[model samples]
Target: MKKIVSSLLIVSAFLLTACGSGNTNSSSASSATNSSTEKTSASSDANSGASEQEYTDPSQLKDSYDVIIVGAGGAGMAAAIQAKEAGANPVIFEKMPIAGGNTLKSSGGMNASETKFQKEQGIEDSNDTFFEDTLKGGQETNDRDLLRYFVDHSADAIDWLDNMGITLNNISYSGGASVKRIHRPADGSAVGGYLVDGLIRNVHEREIPLFVNADVTKINETDDKISGVTVSINGEEKEINAKAVVVTTGGFGSNEEMITKYRPDLKGYVSTTSEGSTGDGIKMIEALGGQTVAMDQIQVHPTVVQKDGMLISETVRGEGAILVNQQGKRFFNELETRDKVSAAETELPEHYAYLIFDDALAKRAKQVDFYKEQGVVEEGATIEELAKKIDVPEETLKATLDTWNKAVADKKDEEFGRETAMDYDLTEGPFYAIQIAPGIHHTMGGVKINTETQVINKEDKTIPGLYAAGEVTGGLHGNNRIGGNAVADIIIFGRQAGNQSAGFVKQ
Candidate 1:
């Protein structure tokens, strides 16, 4: 039944393309020209093995591949590798000059269930607990089935990454989890970049074809089934066919238009996602009659640098940092989930908070030296001098410090539950104030997919030959997403979509 519906849609789309070609010839020609130019620029890297010499633009690419993966981020790369491993010819298409969407900037920590790391730490957890925590965090708007699938498959995805030579340190930081399941790369660089590097290496080893700077503008469908894609490379338009097309172009965290339309609160705020995260996959999927879930749900990172759009990893707070307001009073518990922290800070005067830490914390935290070298911190021999340097009221800061010091000496945080109460006082001098504000980080809503990760249409019908994974498909994170869940969601569903799609070739 699925195959029949897909075939009918394919035939219908071919007819429409043929009939519309004459009337829209000029538009089609322009699109083709733009696409060609972009492709030429992308393939111009001679050292990367791409020929510097120009090649003739093919009128139409032979419309058929076993699998076509869109957006070369974590999900797309995972799907491409999975399809290739399953004996399928997988082609990956990316619009950006470089692959890896928002994932490139991601912390790369993933939440998984019952992992060796968790066991090693003696932290007891299960998929059931993960599901419950996720649904609670999302306020029950998340699809239970998809959430279950995510929890169940998360550990496998981590193992898969390890098998692919992606090194993840077994350190567990705090987030929306009952135990320590979050893993990061050993090099401590961007997690998404590391994942992409591994996937790209695997793709190259497998000799899979990848077309960068190829923007898929349209998904050609007939009678509700997908046929091919109309891609714009450079300025040239080209028609490419595929047996299965996976839309993993990520969410619209960076698109102000979409952000304003759906999540108005995040309109003026900076986003941590990559420049290519413009909801291309969401718009394309919606055009194909797919239904989107939780379109208004957006994640806000609590500790983004106000002057520059750099992510201040939550690990700082998880490791015992504090957030203070202008009055130098501790605002909220830093260990709370990002949404809660952002919400608490939003209600305060000026929607801005300062991340305060002493010399001990400064030396122990990751990226502390980087922050100091970047001049985001103020070093003073006295707390009064530090306050003056950061432009905070010295008296207010001193008073706040006295209260906090007493609390630390007593080994109990009266205002907020700070776990590891360090004995270092501001009297030792050298205080730091990194200005932080809530920034749009991730979109928790996108194309609705079922447990099988198949794209569901507005009519509640499955779109044959159409599948989506990663941030492109919603329902994993309902209203708010936990810290490590984003990575888990992408890789788990990415591989699922790939494994399912590899077996989807029409006889």
Candidate 2:
């Protein structure tokens, strides 16, 4: 996603703040910095005469290779690692100038079940329960086998990342999960930043050559089985051959044209994904005899400010915030999943609402401060003043708060039915408000892949010598994707794609 460029003053601060906050800046630029350094060092360590030919002149890539992987986001990186571990020297090609895909811009943490992290906190979570929650969250439209694979293997994926050096500690109750399972990095940085950096570091240690700026344009194949790919490097076209190709290129959320084609209802909505997420892998593979599923099931998340579509993290509501309409009254419960909240927001009179919280609630969730800094938040001294500032009737707003405060005092919400009850009173002065609307956040549709991570072709059969994972492949998530499950979808299947592709090559 493009940063909302401000004056020079904020740019300098954003440079340092990007990695820390999920609000502004993307980790796409950082990949080139460390990747180039590590690639240089990895090349130098190879045996002198037997060292793999450093890619340049298109002529050198004419020969065949063992395996080729596309995309360098979480799934792509995980695939590269697993492929290497399976004893096949794999070459990775990332389209962006730097390789971290939209995975670097994500704010929500990953989902896992029955991990030691959950046990330490004594949270009762099971893979079966997680599976049922996933099914219910998707409205039971998700592919049973694929959902089963993701649920059963999610804990192992978390352990895999931790063993590879990405440390996830904190757990939060994500909207769709039955119990707490969203795991954040222990350092409090954006999970995308930590996960990307950790995977890149591990790639370097294994001496895998991850070529950045290698924009894969087409899949070169013979008789429809996997072969190799054609990439544009520095405006020069080069074709490289491989026995297997893994397509981990992410979704097309940022592509306005695709959004219009698939879900025309989301045409006017802004997106929160990176520019490189244009569904390249899906398009390229579709051109090569692959089929897609769930193309119409796009997920739009509510509570993202309209200007640049930057997220106002769900913490605001989780901590203690109420969403009110122009009539100065609460509508849906704030803790509802993205799909439910977005639907309610879309049906509103203005197709938007305001999230209001007290000063104490702000103190607990400090990320709201970033929204304030971005000038997207409205502040007021009292409830009536806030109602006035947000164009809601003073008396109506006052009555809403009166009932809300009474509910808080009574420890029961008779209004919209917030089951968590109230954590803070609205009586505190210095109220904050954020005007938000539903926006295109994630694409729940892409290439179709089975439980084994094999890409299915147009004939409804698994494509030989080809595999896919991450947002590039769909069907794991049916109509709506739960918050933390995306990270789970990418890594769990990314590892599986790698392992499967390596196994194919070995056969």
Q: Estimate each model's TM-score.
A: 0.83, 0.84
Candidate 2 accuracy as lDDT: 0.74
- For residues 303-349, could you state the per-residue lDDT of candidate 1 as single tens digits? 87766556676656654467888777787777677799899888988
| Candidate 2 steric clashes | 1
Highest lDDT among the candidates is held by which one? 2
List per-prediction Cα lDDT, in the order shown.
0.70, 0.74
Which TM-score value belongs to model 2? 0.84
